[model samples]
Target: MKKLVISIVLVNLLAACASQKPHETTAAPAAPVAAAATATAPATATVAAAKTAVDPLNDPTSILAGRSVYYPFDVAAVQDADKPLVQAHAEYLSKNAARNVRLEGNCDERGSNEYNLALGQRRADGVMKMLELGGAKAAQLDSVSYGEEKPKATGHEESSWSQNRRTDLNYAK
Candidate 1:
């Protein structure tokens, strides 16, 4: 009976540790993948499931699948770490001309509504400009500011603010 109780406590402790750990990624940087995709011929989708199930844009292995461009507090510029994500999406957009993407700009819940809206717009525009420079056509991109009104995290701390300050790449069908 003592052994069983000890085993249960050990199991609970292990579960608690596992649940508390943050997600870690060892995936290689996104730039090289984008460059490779640009150099190679478009991959053929042989199976019907392949078409919908394995879209490069949605594929976990593809850099194009990354959609968020996180920003620093009070800053609208894209971080160096996230630029590759933007670049990959740019390459994909240039290759697939029919697809349209909306950049939704957001801000943390700390500033005046007017100020946050402007900052969010700047964030979206910054990404839009980068995409254009990366070969995406102006017609394929659009930007909208949600500002403090739409936050990814609800908490009023840095952790939450970090998530809230981002430009989301929302693809249209």
Candidate 2:
């Protein structure tokens, strides 16, 4: 009977030691498998979702007729040769002066926000001045500077940046 009690005590002591010690293998492998699954699963899902979405802004039919003039990047200092384009746009605006028009000036993200804002304002003002010269009433036109807030394309190349820098003409709804 004493041997039986001693054997039981030894068994209980061994069980306690096993429970108290750190679990070195069983817990460690599960953690890495969980982390690996988490890292790869969501990334592929996001990419697939992005591929399915369509961009509304890229539709050419949404562009307004009179306001759709695409200007070169940073043509603030318009030369004598380029004066005709402005003149043509001004004439178009004057004819539709009864309808309110809004000019949104924009720039690429290369410059500081403040500087870009000022530059965009100047570009819109340049167009406004030409329209006024062509007989559009001052009240008919409204100008706003968007700076680098809206980009035409999401590329880092100069071509994409150049396309981003221009004024967009919006007619009052």
The residue-by-residue lDDT of candidate 1 on 74-163, one tens digit each, is 999886667777877888899889999999999998789999999999999999999999999999999999999988889865557767
Window of ten residues with lowest summed lDDT in model 1: 17-26
Error of 1 at 15 (Å): 26
lDDT of 2 by residue, 1-173 (tens): 97787558656644553453223222333354345336646798764563356211222221122243334445564433334444544654565555666777888787788888887887777777776887778898888888777778777645466566676667676
Q: Scored by CA lDDT, what does every candidate get?
A: 0.78, 0.58
**Which segments of model 1 are wrong by more than 4 Å?**
1-39, 42-53
Clashes of each: 0, 0
List clashing residue pairs in candidate 1: none
Choose the strongest candidate by TM-score. Answer: 1
Off by over 4 Å in 2: 1-75, 78-85
